[model samples]
Target: MRSHHSLTNKAWAEFHVDGLPHVHRVFPNGESTMAIVDGLVHGDYVAAAVNDTAVTLTLFSWPASSISRYCYAIHLQIGRVEGPTGRLAVCVQVTAAREVSPVEDYWCMTVDERVALFDRGNAHPVATFRLEYENQRTVELPK
Candidate 1:
């Protein structure tokens, strides 16, 4: 069986959480996608997903924090990548992508209903929500 660490590492794309002030994001490059939570660090409770072309990182929640009645803030990172020379960062809000369900851990959609990917100053959403949780969703992506 695959180790839990292995699974998490595969499902999450790693990125720093110091910048990207808004929320809801996507990234074409694997290493540039991460969500910034208000009171947490990288890998707190983040989700990772991908399509044919790009990857996305989303912040779900912290282990002890309550996201039930708040605005549900998130920090999304998105952009094109070119070597180590690309301006890859932006933030957007993640809202109830899905209706609030009886299962409290399910992922709600962003207010806009989608996470977007685009160049700096451009607005676009990239992926839809498929999971939610009362706690943070850790992520690990393929290297």
Candidate 2:
């Protein structure tokens, strides 16, 4: 993800995705928001995470589809947010048809339900990365 940090506002970070037509912003308190850059499609924020190093967000979108008459496309975005820095870690696009309909309305589903749907193993990873935190001082021993 390409990020732009404002020199004046240390708590503000803004970034955009390559294919997606949206600009995502992360505030100082680890809250994230998105604006439609092109105004062509709509999206919704599904979940978020805050840690010592980063704040992560998950966004969901249902794009139009021609192959599946009954089902729409599923687009999942996983992004990270740190103080004045944000990154789009993973973008998952599921276009294949499913045996059972996932839900009636994605927006109506609870956060836990939405998270479960994302983790249902329908989408496979094309690549994986091993991340190491820079500020780590020690490893916790498993008791």
Candidate 3:
């Protein structure tokens, strides 16, 4: 068997992306998508603690600059997971679950909601997720 290592060495390193001139909309509520960025691993992101059940990267737009490449820092309750080894997954809830609309549709929300959503922070989820592990966070702590 192989040893599962906690994420103690990797981080969200830098990456570059190209955009489409025809696809201009670049927000959670926008429909215009020029390209998609996926296939990420633990060595791709740098979180503070706890290995995770999964990780994924969802890009909505071509970053304006390297400073806006995209990253996140979520607090996962690893100790609370319970399920069969055959099926362990993580469920990430996007803000305004119901109000979420199709890519071509406009989002319905108050100005404050939009402002908060666009506000810059240490973590910027690219409209979705990306798993960042090789063996996966399959630690089976005693129930």
In model 1, where is the ten-residue run with the lowest total lDDT? 111-120
Best by lDDT: 2
Better of 2 and 3 by lDDT: 2
What lDDT is obtained when candidate 3 is compared to the true structure?
0.29
What is the overall TM-score of model 3 with all chains considered together? 0.20
- CA lDDT, candidate 2, residue 119: 35
Q: After superposing candidate 3 on the true structure, give the runs of residues whose Cα lies further than 4 Å from its correct spot.
A: 1-52, 56-58, 61-81, 96-117, 120-143
lDDT of each residue in 3-90, candidate 2, tens digit only? 3653235454554432333323456564445232231122443333444443334444332332332222344544453543343355
Q: Rate the local accuracy (lDDT) of all candidates.
A: 0.35, 0.40, 0.29
State TM-scores per candidate: 0.26, 0.31, 0.20
Ranking by lDDT: 2, 1, 3
Error of 2 at 67 (Å): 2.3
The CA lDDT at 97 in model 3 is: 18
List clashing residue pairs in candidate 2: none
Off by over 4 Å in 2: 1-41, 68-99, 102-119, 126-143
Ranking by TM-score: 2, 1, 3
- Candidate 3 Cα RMSD after full superposition onto the native fold (Å): 15.6
